[model samples]
Target: MRSLVFLVLLGAAFALDDEKIVGGYECKPYSQPWQVSLNSGYHFCGGSLVNENWVVSAAHCYMSRIEVRLGEHNIVITEGSEQFIYSDKVIRHPNYNSWTLDSDIMLIKLSKPATLNQYVQPVSLPTGCATAGTNCSVTGWGNTMSSTADSNKLQCLEIPILSNSNCNNSYPGMITNTMFCAGYLEGGKDSCQKGESLSMDRRNKKEEEGKKEEEEEGEKEEEGKKEEEEEGGKKEEEEEGEKEEEGKKEEEEEGKKEEEEEEEEDKEWKYLMKFEQQS
Candidate 1:
């Protein structure tokens, strides 16, 4: 199930930040924004941490309903493992076009600082100028086939840097100064865009509904199992107690019989009564 409802609003992708997936491409579940979920359920996009407090990703990655998880392994949605960081602010390039994919960049400010770990290191940014044809990595959860399904795992592709002229020719007017194109021209298992399927609002709604149904079913099953155990245990305890009570009653009867026999043996009281009658 999917929910088309954007837990958050939405935005476009970045154009110039071609910082590829040079390092490790971590794909984890849809945990909250900051914390880790049970599984790495989804990869919305690839981002580089510019600082402890800021992460640079495609603006499209930001949804009013979006969540980010840090330090995740598998894609399972866990409730509390991940810390959900709300986008304190979203700063997109001044001149961004949703149609053209130009300046499709944004900065995300985490409410709290990101803890630096081996798996979660910030990538170095190109400040001065990048030479043409410089090698870089592009990592994302985008679809391998534009028409087919998205990759199940986080994917990384390496492509040589293209001169601005060449990039413009490749993508026409889509490649801008803020954006850099790195995917393969032949288009074989090499592409970088943030997130896989910008889960439509309708899909998201369906997903949420499915989750709610699963949760309800799980709760019901738990309740039913608990009741069955309690009833079974009560019956066993009652049967054991009944068996012990029968044994106790037999012991009491044997004790009474021994007293009666001892009384029968004591006849001296009868002899005293007869002596008194003769006097």
Candidate 2:
């Protein structure tokens, strides 16, 4: 349950570079076809369509007054293609921890399937998490600047994926099996602003050859996550030499961390000095 205005944009460049979720540009209509806005009567969190009848979002933004709006660029005006649907079912992950924000995922089941059109489509769930260098795009109707007020259009930016270890540094002891991190290393653009939505999806191609993975069903998905994590682990040591300064703040905290605790934090941050550092 949150709010926002809309943003206007020119052509899009998918290449990754210096940009801000904080310094993001408002998205033009049709540029992002899979984003959805979760309305809790007023403002809302960002979401993505997994299928015609289901949408996924963060559990931390949960509220009772939930509604799903698709093909929406601005909330104030109603366009012909925009479809408003009520949530028939809301399932926060069984293991979702409110305090730690672990497994921050929720599923919204619409009363009926949304009609597929040019403006509305589902984002493909990768067979596994994206690799370290993948440029994942996050879009939302959050604030244009750092402040709480949102714009009239959706905002989007491409952020490279950071490993679990690097992500854990930002949120002490918070990263989990179901979550992967992506944001500016220096803290610029981010879609999780006040009154904004956190809509995101991976742009990687689906693995058609991996259809056999459907056999194990749930078991296979867990394996895929492990594989992705291991793939990123290859360059962990190289990243540790850098990123030492940015972590000093998180390192300082309020009081001293025990020797054992410091040891663990170091273990997690040994990779992902920056999202684009693989080169």
Candidate 3:
């Protein structure tokens, strides 16, 4: 998906910054492990779930195909995990523009509704379609170190909402009213990196190889089946030829017997005529 690729590029362009936190800013963990696992692929740059029907994340997150695995505590590869839910649909704000990164928000609709537990409850939205400056928490699975995917805990940091005017000045032609900005005012402390691009590249290569192997094997099997059918058909034709030859031989024999009987009858008639003349 173009969106997924775009997101990786975007992360490279904006590496995460580890600068000092603003005075009141604090980072917290999500209460539920399930909440953290569902949004694993994305960095905590900007995203939220609006309701059971929709997960509101950054539009850039949607640019890539994302798997939202619910109910997992950590990010280890495991089978039959209880908190696994895949995203069925993605809806980015209609007005989103990548050049500006404005209207950066998006909504993800799940194929099935999520079960609510204390650890897996929905985050609250600001009342009244709140404007920027309304305090909110940002959570994600971004790497704590540069250019790496971080551990799978639901890491979050609290940020005061910056006014749309201020965000525009910072990102210019890169911010829109439909979106908001957070993090330190200084540039270095807040960023996403290019290293994530490498991880995705590796994954793509593996997938391509798998497909190629599958196709080759399928072709071989099909060829073998065709050969078998041809051999069977030839055997059937040979049997039919033998039957036709036998039928022809029987017909010729029947014709010869009928001719012999006609000859005998003609001879008997001639003898009777001669006897009558003598009398």
**Per-model CA lDDT versus the true structure:** 0.49, 0.61, 0.48
Candidate 2 minimal-lDDT segment of 10 residues: 4-13
Off by over 4 Å in 3: 1-47, 63-65, 77-82, 129-135, 187-279
Tens digits of per-residue lDDT, candidate 3, 52-80, equal 65555556556444566654434555434
Alpha-carbon RMSD, each predicted model = 19.2, 31.3, 19.3
Encode model 2's per-residue lDDT on 1-279: one tens digit a residue.
111111111001111121225667777786666678778776556677778998777665566557888888876787777988888988887987766555556777898899889888876654444566455566777556545565668776766667667767766664556555666678665645321233223212334324445656657777888887876674564466456644775676533566667777776666545434764
TM-score of each: 0.49, 0.61, 0.49
Best by TM-score: 2
lDDT of 1 by residue, 169-262 (tens): 7667565556654444554434434532111123444577899999999999999999889888888888888878988888888888988877
Which candidate comes out best when scored by lDDT?
2
- Candidate 2 clashes: the total is 19
Whole-model lDDT, model 2: 0.61
Could you tell me the TM-score of candidate 3?
A: 0.49
